[model samples]
Target chain A: MSTRKQEFLAGARNTFPLLLGAFPFGLIYGALAVTSGLSVGAAMAMSAFVFAGSAQFIAVGLVAAHAPVLIIILTTLIVNLRHMLYSATLLPYLKKLPQTWRIPLAFGLTDETFAVAIHRFRKNDSSRFKHWYQFGSSLAMYLNWQLWCFLGLVLGDRIPDASGWGLDVAMPITFIGMLIPFVKNIPTVVCVLTAGAVSLLTLGMPYKLGIIVAAFMGILAGFITEQTGKKIQVEIQV
Target chain B: MTANEWLMILGMMGVTFGIRYFLLALADRIRMPSPVEVSLQYIPPAVLIAITLPAVILPHGEWHFSFTNPYLVAAVIAAGCGLLTKNLLATIACGLAAFFAYQILLSS
Candidate 1:
């Protein structure tokens, strides 16, 4: 019973909390980028063009440190490597569409968008325009990110120590909520715990390499556990 | 904006887009082997935990797993809330409130 408009609105509506979660992140990026030496126009343009929150923040810091353009772009690639996982994960749901539809949808993908859109795609439905749902989530994230960036820029210097404000807590909190449903099986439980432990152990890796390392460790652990679990079941049945 | 500034931002845009679109663009051309395909479901939770656990348990990017850490205390409370309520809104509300309250208490 979902039309395109309804589907899109549902995506935006469900994305409301995450929008709040990202608010301070974008605001801090914009405010901090300006305070760090980038001109206001350049900062805004970065948000408009790059649109990746964490990368933009790191780029701002590197620019302040006078890092070369090649280094900045390289760092952007490594940091955003996570998005490729998201894209790959969602490909099954989106591959049937044309380039015209896929192009904008891909451009709008973010962690929040992927997190939100994935759930809808997983849902049992018969709607012909489910991509519109992702379109909604992606557009919401994009607009929300830009608006917060603008505010942070306008409020530059007025908001000092934006990072110290503890608003980043939203990311973990929202993520925890999203993660609970995924912990419904033994392999998933192992995955979460293994990932958690490795993250703390590898906390010192540069450029957020620990995240990538820990994620791989968790996935490996989960895969092994699942295989062993299946073997045990087969033996028990025999 | 200066040419260098423009170069930096545009380069970032290109790379970010390229990475995000790489897999989607090649969905038909590239198919992951079955084992890798089975492992795909684990990616979201693993990556999310890898990101969140460190942020919560090691809020300051160092090991301080004690009652003094407001982020840890808030996150634990929030997890409990999430488990009991199974509601995203409630979880975030409790987590943020707990974080701010614990921060104020520790400072004063």
Candidate 2:
């Protein structure tokens, strides 16, 4: 196989597991966007432009609530701030990539894309193929997302309403599936509890500001727990 | 005109692209604080739970702390199944089953 083909193959292999999650999630997004009163064009366009699943869900909720557009924009910012970290993690590997390859790759850096690509890069222990691997993984995920989302929009009306089809269960179920893998550390456990409590407490807040509050509180709680752990580790060494 | 909507979407896209690219461009010029790194690591699980729990338990916009709410029961089962199996499909199936079963029991 040619070097390019090899890189693409490696990318596909790395992203296959991520696609398992993205397919259903994108379907849920498409179905929700349609049922939430978005035009099929708008829904598909959103997948093309925004491409962030959770942010799109929040946008649908805001649309349903008749929220001001400014608030929607602000909420999207806060919710997606974590993408900065993804960009940060990939920066070292991407330093040598030309602008032609960088912009599209940056747009495709969703949670699953970053996870699979980073995992591959770490496992490979080589920077030579990092960009190629990332490109491949992200391309697969991007294509998978667009296809499922389009399918969902096309078949959206046929699917039963949220109450009838139990489609409302998708988000929570997906989240639960994600959470199971990360509860190993005490810091993570504390972060979940603190964020949950904070979110519930602030549920009455307006314009989904509660999400922002919960996010900040959760981050603080996690940092404290991590620091405490590190301090204990140091003392133990001493 | 509703053309404004498209403009708004495009403008928002610009803003988003700017934020994401800002750090990508600055990655070499600066180092993130230790606290910032620690906090970013915790964001996924925290945000996921924050978004999920309310939707499941507060389907009616109020806390219905009872077994009568089928969605909550289904969510708990789904969460357990997910934790045990670590599969999205399995978790969603359990949730769907619990939701429909509770709905049936409620009607009966």
Best by TM-score: 1
Clashing pairs in 2: none
Model 1 chain A poorest ten-residue lDDT run: A155-164
Off by over 4 Å in 2: A1-38, A58-75, A88-98, A115-124, A130-134, A158-164, A236-238, B86-108
lDDT by residue for model 1 (A153-220), tens:
88867876776788878778888877876777999999999988998888888888888889899999
DockQ scores of all models, one per candidate: 0.78, 0.46
Off by over 4 Å in 1: none
Residue A201, candidate 2: C-alpha displacement in angstroms: 1.9
Report residue A96 deviation for candidate 2 (angstroms). Answer: 5.5
CAPRI quality level assigned to candidate 1 from its DockQ score = medium
In candidate 2, position A38 carries an lDDT of 66
Highest-lDDT candidate: 1
What DockQ class does candidate 2 belong to?
A: acceptable
Q: How many residue pairs clash per model?
A: 0, 0
